[model samples]
Target: MRCHKLVAYSVSAAAMVTLVAAGDAWEIKSQNKLVKHCANREGYDVCNIVLDISDTHALCSVCRLNRTIPDLAKPENRLRWSKLEQAKRRLLIGLMDLHLPLEAPVRGYSRGLCFDFLEDQRSNSDVAQKFITTGHRDGVITINILEADDVQRVWQREHVGERYRTLLGHMRHEVGHYYFELIVSDREGFGQIFGDVDTAYEKALKNYYARGPLPGWEQSHISAYASAHPAEDWAECFAHYLHMADTLETATAHRLIEQFSEQGDFEQLLLLWDRFSASLNEVNRSLGLSDAYPFVITPIVKNKLRFIHSAIARYVGLQL
Candidate 1:
């Protein structure tokens, strides 16, 4: 887990139950017997229920990944942590759906996905630690507790000129680094698909950060940071694929579009996404907001995404 660092939900504000639609063909259990509003996105295969009960913690068997819980010293912090957990679980559900291997020492041998919801002095004056970077290292993903705070997240968003940002996006992007290790670093046949990952990662990263994104970078990358390196490119692409697939399935499940079952299989899913994202963009426009999905999925990128889908299908024992 240390060797690689490529790493790379929803439900509602209050009501305990709601339904999720996965195209027209699939309907996953949205709520557990406890009536916790839930939906399987990426990591649900391993944990029947991704979120913990109101008072307990649940271990993720597939990833064997749980570290520290956020200190809920402040009354509101607990609620924030719970919301963060929900987002984390939803993200893991998507990773599981992809069938990408996990690499955590806790889970032993290629099974690794872990989290630590940590706090700092900013969030809790009593805490000795002053700052915590949200990053992944040695089989663990550590998120600063402040990220769960609305004020902090919004501040960071505006500082970055990003069209979209969220706790789930951070989780997904970091996990993208993790999966890069799993699929590209150590796996064979990856070079054939993703190009050689041997390009100096550290050097590329420095240049990306120093000069900012390439001029007119939209022609090349989905986000400014994506131009950092090939590894980053892969991670960004991985995250985008998950974003696209998850939203499409949810939209389909909600009857926002044609039923997925009637539409057909994975190919149909792609078609649906193409149609749905346009409306999603326009809806955001009407609200004077950035497009929900701003990046264009180029033909080359589409083929790369298909490779990811094929990998997931193989993991699930489906004939791709």
Candidate 2:
């Protein structure tokens, strides 16, 4: 059995995270502290543990979106949720850094976002479903806590014949679906590149599962699963764009590359990603690990990425 220490904190007019049992008088106070006693607020034992903590800042904005968390009665579930939160923080931070939309939808629109880290029958027999799929709907991204388990995640990846899969990859892919709803709306060049967007998702996915993605899926889609549907194609491309953006930013931050920019030159970004990913793959090989990036970005996939790049530029600034 595991136990957590409870701490009370208050930050006037900003936010406060009161660590206590749910349904308590102070439930839903702020964030992060909901799981642990670290509210990032002053006067708490854990306050100022990191340079990021300050009196002006209380519960982090990222932890505020969590609608549900795993059952902490099991020690492994806590670690799994920790992994999920880490990846989720990276995802939300990356999107916010790009000046993209992060607000959870207020009314019938994708203006905001939320997350639900849930478990199903696989982890608990009393749960509702046998499996919990990682997906996005109406601005809520649901991730199965099992995805945090490396052994299980790796089994699923190979069973599904995926070339690349990771906790961050799943977050990027699902958020791509969320952003697709926000970014593409009767926009020009979408259909020209991603093909029809009106295909019935259920039927299309049913066929995709039964027969698998079409042959030569590599020539056009970013991954075999991207060929499952037009929507998925857009999501895969969007995820790749995010990978490029985040990795490029990291490379620069670490001084791995002196020249990197997210402005104006999409072509230049592509060139940088090609070289960086190549070096990254080589480094993995030196470590006797698999390639960091296994798939090649074909011309069609590049066009889709280009469309996403332009959409993001428009999203960030009203650029043409």
TM-score, every prediction = 0.70, 0.82
Ten residues in sequence with the least summed lDDT for candidate 2: 43-52
Q: Write the per-residue lDDT of candidate 1 for residues 43-150, one digit (tens) a residue.
A: 232223334334243332422355687654567766776667768767866665455555544222344778888888877788788888787765577888778777
- Summarize candidate 2's per-residue lDDT along 1-320 as a digit string, tens digits: 14554443332222223344654223434554333223533332223122123325445555567788788788788678878877876686578667787785433564478888989899888888898899999888899989999999999999999988899999999989888876775455798889888889999999999999989998988899999999999988888888889889889988998788776589998999999999999999999999998979988888888889888887668522
lDDT of 2: 0.76
In the order shown, the candidates' Cα RMSDs to the true structure are 10.4, 7.5
Q: For each candidate, how many residue pairs have backbone atoms clashing (under 3 Å)? A: 26, 5
Model 1 scores a C-alpha lDDT of 0.63
* CA lDDT, every model vs. true structure: 0.63, 0.76
Residue 319 in model 2: shift from native, Å?
A: 10
lDDT of 1 at 215: 88
